[model samples]
Target: MAGRWVKPEVFPLFAAVGAVVGLCSMQLVRNICTNPEVRVTKENRSAGVLQNFEEGEKYAQHGLRKYVRGRRPEVMPNLNKFFSDPK
Candidate 1:
């Protein structure tokens, strides 16, 4: 079986399978070429919402500022009372 040519009966089967595969590939190519919706274009491509890194950084900075503004004086009060402590 190593070097034997394909049997005559099997040759027709192989040809039929090859023809079906070729027709399927041709139809796939034609569908891709004829269908505008299936084609890749800039308008159809999704513009990812997270594409802007700088805008995200700005929002983070604004949030941090708001967070710090609420607790700045409460967390870091003036230290002048240390020397004025009555002992």
Candidate 2:
């Protein structure tokens, strides 16, 4: 007697739960294939920008060190120094 289906309301409840789960799973699959959260190209572009910034920082540090040491003049010497006719 206890094994018999005694509650009719449970059928509709189960049906509603199944429909909700099906719709949610479909939406999840659609979102995964159509609209990703992260883009590889954008990440690579940002990484390139960061790398360029770091290189510029290193160059600036070298310039500052050279200036503090007073080893070189502000204006670089002419390239002709290497190719000039013998004195």
Candidate 3:
């Protein structure tokens, strides 16, 4: 003997409409709370600020080295004689 399945009368009326509404509401709530745990780790959030400053100092010194190498002033120039152009 097999048991007969009974479908509730209320289900026939609201099933399609209820399913659509419930799923849409579920998606809305899911999107609202998606990234619920807002967190910034110790390393990720602030590492760049200080690190970039330090790296900038290094880069400045590197450029300074090149500039100083190309254009360097001597200790003293003989002001009296050099003024006269030997033509």
Candidate 4:
């Protein structure tokens, strides 16, 4: 019988590593594309130094961060509210 080159037991390990690497790469790309500090357009690239510092500061917070900033912190908000109700 011909011997198999790769054992099947290691497939899950390979998949997990690949998933981590893919997620990291995608996050890096997303940051590069959306970050105000890292301008990518031609107009933005040619702007005078310090010209938009104030504007940049306005959008400095990441989208997710801005959304979460106004939210109340809770491990499980729905569950906590349910148990804490006076009914």
Name the best candidate (by lDDT). 4
Clash count, predicted structure 3: 0
lDDT by residue for model 4 (1-87), tens: 334535788679879999999999988897687656676888987874655666576657667789899899987999999999989
lDDT of 1 by residue, 42-77 (tens): 655564333556645564466458778666455335
Task: State every prediction's TM-score relative to the real structure.
Answer: 0.42, 0.35, 0.27, 0.48
The residue-level lDDT of candidate 3 at 29 comes to 69
Best by TM-score: 4
Worst 10 residues of 4 by lDDT: 1-10
Stretches of candidate 1 off by over 4 Å are 2-5, 41-87
Regions of model 3 farther than 4 Å from truth: 1-11, 35-87
Candidate 2 has what TM-score?
0.35
Better of 1 and 2 by lDDT: 1
Best of the two (1, 3) by TM-score:
1
Instruction: Quote the positional error of residue 5 for candidate 1 in Å.
Output: 6.7
lDDT (Cα, tens digit) per residue for candidate 3, span 1-87: 222333476566668879899999976764454322322565554555443556455544564577777653754445534775574
Cα lDDT of candidate 2 equals: 0.59
Q: Which residue pairs of candidate 4 clash? A: none
**Considering lDDT, where higher is better, how would the candidates rank from best to worst?**
4, 1, 2, 3
Per-residue lDDT, model 1, residue 39, is: 38
Clashing pairs in 1: none
